[model samples]
Every structure is written in C-alpha cells, then in structure tokens.
Target chain A: MTKYQRIYQELLDKIKTKEYKTGDYLPSENELMKTYGSSRDTIRKALQLLLQNGYIQKVVGKGSVVLDSERIAFPVSGISSFKELKESMDGTIETIVEEFTVVPADDKLKDELHMDDGNVYIIERVRSINGEKIILDKDYLNGNIIQGLTKQHAQDSIYEYIENELNLNISFSRKEITVIPATKHDKEVLDMLDYDLLVCVKSYSYLEDATLFEYTISKHRPDKFRFVDFARRSQ
Target chain B: MTKYQRIYQELLDKIKTKEYKTGDYLPSENELMKTYGSSRDTIRKALQLLLQNGYIQKVVGKGSVVLDSERIAFPVSGISSFKELKESMDGTIETIVEEFTVVPADDKLKDELHMDDGNVYIIERVRSINGEKIILDKDYLNGNIIQGLTKQHAQDSIYEYIENELNLNISFSRKEITVIPATKHDKEVLDMLDYDLLVCVKSYSYLEDATLFEYTISKHRPDKFRFVDFARRSQ
Candidate 1:
C-alpha cells in the first residue's frame, strides 16, 4: 500500500481498538506526519478520507477529534420507534411538527405501515440538532396506538408521551435510508432550500411481543446525514 | 387541496388498494378526464405526480401499467441473508465477489456487528439481475463461521455454501439501506462513472443462537435499484 494508505489503515486500526474514543483528540498534523514518516499532503489526504466517511471530524482550531460514534451506529433492530429513539435522546434535540392528520394510508403507506386492515395517523415533522433542522420525519401510526393524536402533540416528541405518559413498552425497529430530491414541503419544513438533495431514512418499529408499533419515513439533508456500521468475517 | 391533488389521491388510492396490480393497465387519459371531471392539463398534472413517485410506469404505445410496489416484504422473524433471498428467487440472478480478506474488526465494526472479540472476514461484491449490475455488496463475516474461505469460494454465494455445504443454520438479518455518491471503486466495480449516485444497502445476519454471522454492505446504481419493504404500524 502507499504511505498514505498505510497510515490511514493504521489510524483506522487505532480507532477500532479504542485508542481514541469519540471526542478524543488526535495528534497534530505535524506529529502524525513525523510518526508516519510522511509529508503533510499525504497525511491530509488520509484524514480527508476519514472525514468523508464520517469517522473523524475537524474543528477550525481544535484540529481533529473523534465524532460521537453512536451517531452512525448499527441500523436499529427490533422495536424502538424513531419517535421513541428521538425521545430517548438528550432533551436538547427539538422537533417542529409540520403536518399531522388522519389520512387513509395510500398503497405505499399501506405497504410501509402494513395497514392493510385499517386507517393510519400520518405525522410529518422536522428534527433539530441544537437549533438547526437536520432531519424531516414523516411517520405513520396505527390509529390503535393513539386514538386522537393532533398536530399540537406532534410539535414535541410523540414517543416520549407514548412510553412515559401512556406507559407503552417501546422495543425494536427496522430501518432503511436512501436519497431523494427535496420536495417543496421539505423546503418549507426545513425553512431552507439551499440544498438540492435529501437522504431518506425509513423505519418500522415493533412492541415487546413483536407487534408493529410505528412506521416512520424520515428525510435528512444530504450534507447532514451520516451512517455507520461494524462488520466481521463469516466463517 | 387542488382539483389536481384530488385526482392524484384518488388514482393513488386505487393503486394502493391493488385496484390495479402489477402489469395491470389503468384507464386512458380521456377516460380518466371524464371520470375525474377535469381539464386535460389538470389531469396530466395529477398523472405526473404518480409517475414521479414510481406508482405507475408509462409505456410508449401501450399506455401505463401499475408498477410493482417497491416496498419489500422482509420476513422479520426468519434468519435469512440477502444471498439466500436472491437464491430463493432462483437462477435469474448472479453475484461476483470482488474482494475478500481477513481484516481486524475495529470498534465501529465491532459495535455495528456486535463483535466484542476476535477478527472478521471482509467481503465485497456486486449482484446483478438478468445481467444488469443492480447491487454492490460489502460484507464482514464472523471468523468462526467460515474459517478457511479462499477468495475464489467467496466469489460465489457464501450463505448457500454455508447452509447447504457447511451445515450452519443462517437465521435472521437486520438490514438498512441508504444513498451515497459513487466512490472511485464504485465506478470500477459497477462499471459506470458518469452517474455518481448509488443506493447502498447493509444487513446483519444472525445464526440460530443469535450470533451475528455476517454484516453485508451493498451499493447499486440508483436508477436501476428498487427496494421493496412490507411495513407494519406499531400497535
């Protein structure tokens, strides 16, 4: 492998072994170059790859620091709803519910929510990190879950009230993410249309006994969304 | 809602309910115009929305046929890999394992695969449907599952060989899909460079005892890939 590649692999190995945890600082460019016996350009290239892959992030003066590893953790398994996950996260995160209503689920909605036998509660909202809108959440809830949900409740974390207040046991979730165009509604919900692309994450959540609890379709601004996975060799 | 939206929703409702199944034809423009009592331009607008969302596909001389719903029906309780799912779909598919090697499972990799100990086998591949490259797969397998795999054998379906030849029972998989730009290698593997967009899919498979057997990552040329999911609302 080339010198840069070698260094990249070594750094990856170190990160994997937990030599550096999320938010941990790494050596300066000069130090990394000195240790790896490489030039600044080569070292920068390696760092660029990690940044592009969402592994490490750089601050203006702080140099490079590990990101929150959980940000790109494995695709959720089993029953946790996006609503539930959002609720469970730190309270600093906020949501601006854009639309919520009782609409007959379309075939796409029916197929996604598995609502072949009934109506669906469609809720659309945007999630904010700090104060910036980063994710647009479009969810379909069984009318059975919340009989009379309104737009007022959607403005906050719905999952919080469902589990903490209503006392429902939220368990596992299956999710998928894809890219799509930014629709007019997306522009309105996010309050900005500077970007042209959106990353869509679709998820299905189930209860403790394996009963489906929530079906959510979310869209994130492409530049803001990152996904990560851990993999091993099969025998 | 606009008159056009009303027409669009009505048509969408029909397709969602399987009032039109795959390969089933819809009424012509003139027929729809009369039924919805709208002008030609208004009717066209409604039809355009359906086409944009992939609900119906229009043919040149034959008109429009209800497109197959792209939502996939995944057996949530079963322990099957994408390899097995394609195989059961029969010889209509082919796979080319591009690269395979034993790699150290890093913290991110360990976390994603839940591999707290030991090494992993990393496998990369492309899957084709009827000779068209549709999915690019990158996987990490548990070393204990397939200890002595050569790169040559990895070229074929590893899951099939594991179950039919090795006698290891492959059971359940948790998967996620997303969209990404084509990497330099993606161009070489998918054999395209002009289109920099790709759809990425990842799945984590488990053995009968819940041991993660494999972590598979796949990418596809977006225009050519359509995902199907059978979703259910949380109860």
Candidate 2:
C-alpha cells in the first residue's frame, strides 16, 4: 500500500464504521496531510478515490461532505429494484410509460412467461437518470392476477401496487444478466450513440406462494450499468 | 399463460421437486402430447426450452437425458468462485498461468489494493472453456500476508491453496460488474474476434479477520458471460 492507498483504506473504514457520519465534512486537506504525514498530492489522491466511489462529495468551498450512508454504500447494489436504487441515488429520475396495454398472450410471450393461454399486461418504460435516457424496461405482468393497471401505475411503482394494494408478497427473483449489442429500439431511444454495448438483466419474479408473476427485461447503457454485490461465504 | 407454458412450468416444477430426478428420462413427447392434449409442435417447443435452459440434453440414440441437477441449475451463479462454478458446470476448463511474479507495489497497484509499501504477487491467467479462450483473470495478492505463492498454485486454484494449505478463512468480497469495450490485450489474447464487448468483474476480497488480501479483475467475452442471481426479499 502506498501512502494514498493507506489513507484511503483508513478513511473508508472510518466512513463505513460511522466514525465520520453522513453530512459531516471530512478533515481539510492540510489536516489530513498533517495527520498522515503524506504530501498534498497523496491526500488529494485519497480524496479522489472517495469521491469516485460515491463515499463523499467535494463541495466547492466546504471540503468533502459525507453523502447519505444509505443513499450510497460500499457497493451500489444488493437486492434493490431499479426504482428503489434510483430513489436512493437521489438523481433526477423519470419513468416514461411508453406503452401500457393488455394483449392475449402470443405464443412467444406465453413461452417467455411459461403460460398456456391468458391475457397479459405489457408495460414499456424508459428510465432517464440525471436527464439522460439510459435504461429501457419492458415488463410482462400476468393479467389474470394483475386484473387492472394504468399508465399512472406504470409511471409510479408497479411493484409497490402489487405488494401494497394487491397484498401480494414479492418473494424472490431469478435474474440472468448478459451483455449484448444494442438493438434498433435501444439505438433509437437510449442516449448511447457512441457506446455500442448494453447490459441486459432479464428477470423472472415470483410471489411468496411460489407463483411466478412477472418477467422483466431491463436494458441499460453499458456505462450506466453498475452492479455491485456483497457475498458472504456460504457454509 | 398458454397451454405449453403451463406444461413447461409443471414439468419444471416436477424436475425441481425431484419428481423427475437426475438421469431420469422425462416422459416421451408422445406421452406428454397425449397427457396435455397439446400438438407435437407445442410439446417440442416446451422441450426445446427445457433443453436451452439446461434441464435436459437430447441424445441421438436416446431421448432427452436428465442432466446432473447440481451441474445445471435454475440459475447458473450464486456465491461460487470461477473454478467452483466451472466444476459444477462439468466443462473442460483449463487455466493457463501466463505470468506469475513478485513486483514491488507501485503506486497504482498499491492504490488498487489499498496498501502503503509492500511486495505484491501478480498472477495473470487465461481461462479456456471447452477449448475456447473466454476469460482472463488477473490476481494481486498481498505478499505481506501470503508470504509466498508459486505458479503451480495459480495453475490449480489460489483460493483452494489459501484455504486448505494456508488455513485462511475466506470471508466475503465486494464485486463491481460493468460492461465495456474490449481492450487491446483482450482482443489479442481472447478468442473473440466477432464479439467486441467484454464483461468485467473486479473484486476486492477480505479474510475472516477483515484483512483485505486479494484484488482480482476477471475479464470475459460478452457472449460467454452469464451472470444469474437469486435474490430473496430482505426484511
């Protein structure tokens, strides 16, 4: 470990352990330099890593202010949905309900959902973060259980409606993630003309009673796709 | 849900419940068609999904053979290491130790590992699956703790050596996943001419005592990359 790295680890440990709580400004550069006996360059490098990792924000004149602990974390993701994660990010997020309709399950759609013959609700949404269109979400809901849905429901949180209003438990999900080329639809909608890759996370969600209820494919511009995980060794 | 999807779900449920055990051949297409009153195409479609999803494999002389339950699963990955997952996959996997040397920790290397000044072991390896070079794994070990590591250890499994030989309790890791354009090294080493995208999983691993000892960057060709996750709702 070099001087900057040692300082980074120590400061990060302090931040995570709440020795430096959220909203508290970190010590000035001079203070950190004096404490570590590291040069100004070394201190700045440590602070830069913290900023890049979203641990702290360098205010123009107020030094580095610790961000919300829950809003940011050691890893950006655990088990949160796009809406949930975006809410924590506190960015200017907007969900555009591009298309919301009910259709008799086609063979392909039925196959994807593992269904026989029933109506399904389709929701096509584009997610813009910080004024940039980065994610396109396509969802298929079992219309039998989800008897009613509207654009308003699509714009807001559909999961919230399913769990709260419909009183269903969102138990678990199986997600298959892959990176693939951008499709025509993605090219047209996503603001990633220069970048050619997209990270697709296709999920099959189940209810508490073991009912497979939803299938969603979320396509994100590669640069905007950030997946972080914390894995505890399984016994 | 259509009739075929319902059948798919039922058969999948049976396979998962072990009603259709590993090595137990599934009911014939004729039998399934008769039982479900579905057409041959529909039954074939359902079986195709089963095959695609790795539930069963078709044999020319024999019917679809039930696959190894653990070798194949509902989702491919959980908390397993690359070797662990590959072994379960039953693939002919080869790990070539390209470079294994001890380097004085440079500032960048030290910064990545959060260290001040110590010797660090660099291990560069290429992973081939079924004869195709699909992954490149670069590992950095904290030489201060590892003391010594040989190329033979890299050829086998570093984690295994750490646990069985060194008696280190492997704890947890923080992983960051992203998709990016292939680098020059990636293009030169990986046998992925047609594929231009790469999925990168960079990890920082710590010991049971919270000693950060390992840093790894695993680069994979996009088509060969499959990240499956199972998320249980947290309270």
Predictions in order: lDDT? 0.66, 0.78
Q: What CAPRI-style quality would you assign to candidate 2?
A: acceptable
Please give the lDDT score for candidate 1: 0.66
Per-model TM-score (chain A alone): 0.56, 0.68
Model 2: what TM-score for its first chain?
0.68
lDDT of 1 at A181: 72
lDDT of 1 by residue, B127-193 (tens): 7777777678887887766677677667666777777787876643444555677788788777553
lDDT of 2 by residue, A6-50 (tens): 899999899989999977889999999999998897898798667
Model 2 C-alpha RMSD vs. true structure (Å) is 16.3
- Estimate, for each residue in B49-116, the C-alpha lDDT of model 2 and write its tens digit: 67545466555455766654453253335345666777657669898888899999999988877689
Least well predicted 10-residue stretch by lDDT in candidate 2 chain B = B69-78
lDDT of 2: 0.78
